[model samples]
Target: MDTLTSTSANTWPIISNIIGWTYFLSWSCSFYPQTILNFKRKSVQGLSIDFLYYNVFGFLCYSIFNLAFFFSEDVQDEYRRRHQDSDNLVRANDVLFAVHAFLISFLTLSQTFIFKSDQKLSVTAKTFLLTFIVFILTAIGAVFTEYIKWIDVLYFLSYIKLLISFIKYIPQLWMNYRRKSTIGWSIHNILLDLSGGILSVAQLVLDAAISGDWSGITGDPVKFGLGFVAIVFDLLFMSQHYIFYRERYDFYLAVDDSERQALLPTEQS
Candidate 1:
């Protein structure tokens, strides 16, 4: 029994690391699908600009959180002591993922400006102004936190990121519902996001189980909750794409065919 328990304990971190890397890879690639879809379609129609707006800000907060955690001596020391590793608990890929997310979201936002779309889902001028103001305020806050050496602001930024993550999908989900179709959104992106979210939660679970440290599970409730919520949203998106949109598309096709038949005799005469 002792040998079995020892082996499981030894194997868990390796499994956790594997899951972490899988999540990193999934997250890294997730944004590309939307970018590519937008480029190929040459339009941001049916895509919510508000989603991109919130996403860029969310990624910005997440990036700050990762950078602050990675650089904090206190955080590094604690992680090293607990894990008996020289490296901090926060992985370099976390920072990289955050950076990539911001960049990709920015790219998607650029598409909203550059591409012409008749879709009403696009952000309004008033919303753009509001977003600009928010950005400026956030920048000022960041500067203030840095100059004052208010390190606890890092936690605030992390919580903001979590809040943004929780709400960011809402606009997109609502837009899809209003449109009754997921026409312009990329299912590939949602699938990748789901994979990443599941892997992230799995890593946390494995780590907690292996270390027999339940506190580790609750230590970062934001991270855990974000993963779970993201997965739920991703699944909702998949259902919208596969089930709801499919039905809507078929209905539209039938209506179009009927209209065409009705016009046939008029055109013939």
Candidate 2:
């Protein structure tokens, strides 16, 4: 059972912190444009409710996972015991990013309630949410019944978040396709998210370089996969905004220019 040579905390502490916080800010900032857009339109029209539901729930799980792994000695010990004493990869920025992302996602959900919009959680979203509820409850039962450790509960929570990451973006992409426009949705959000995803993957590479082992990535391929998925979706969104739906977007602003005026913020390609 080959694994990372040494994982008792990161060796490159300062450099790791810098990379961690940079991506933290980038990923945390990714929610702003959508928030601002919702305010500008006084609507969450093009924003998908399914996306928000998934986003909010996913981040909540992620937040718990990060917080527990980073802050809980019991969880940390259990994790190490399970993983042959491998240090948990969670960093301060990981906890901060997860908490901040959850807050932002929750704020966006609140906006959906305040604004004028007809979108409701899809049956699919509801089903997934309910399914996660069952998953979470079962994890709790396992923990209390001594079937699994608290750290295992944390991992299960993260797994739900991971599953949601793969599913969350689809609604937004489909909405853009159906409307043939990316107007109400902000492209800036995608750009910032793309930067975060790229940086996240880069950070993994940097860690591997310093450690002289790629096992950090290979060991938990889900982390790498999540970054890759985000990057792929961000690129697809870039295409939808800049190429596929440019005409529709331009026409939207052209028609609404009189009303939207300066309220509709513009972004660069």
Best model number under lDDT: 2
For candidate 1, the clash count comes to 0
Flag regions of model 1 displaced more than 4 Å.
1-4, 74-89, 117-151, 247-269
- What TM-score against the true fold does each predicted structure earn? 0.75, 0.86
Q: State the lDDT of candidate 1 residue by residue for 116-143, as single tens digits.
A: 6554434553464366457546755876
lDDT of 2 at 70: 82
C-alpha RMSD by candidate, in order: 6.3, 5.0
Error of model 2, residue 150, in angstroms? 1.3
Root-mean-square deviation of candidate 2: 5.0
lDDT of 2 by residue, 1-269 (tens): 23333563455556666877898889989999999878876778778999998999998988898888789998888766766666667678778888899899999989987985788788989998999999899989988999888877877887788899999999999998887779778888999898888878877766665655555565445456668999999999999989888854442334465655544544222
> TM-score winner among the candidates?
2
Cα-based lDDT for every prediction: 0.72, 0.79
Worst 10 residues of 2 by lDDT: 260-269
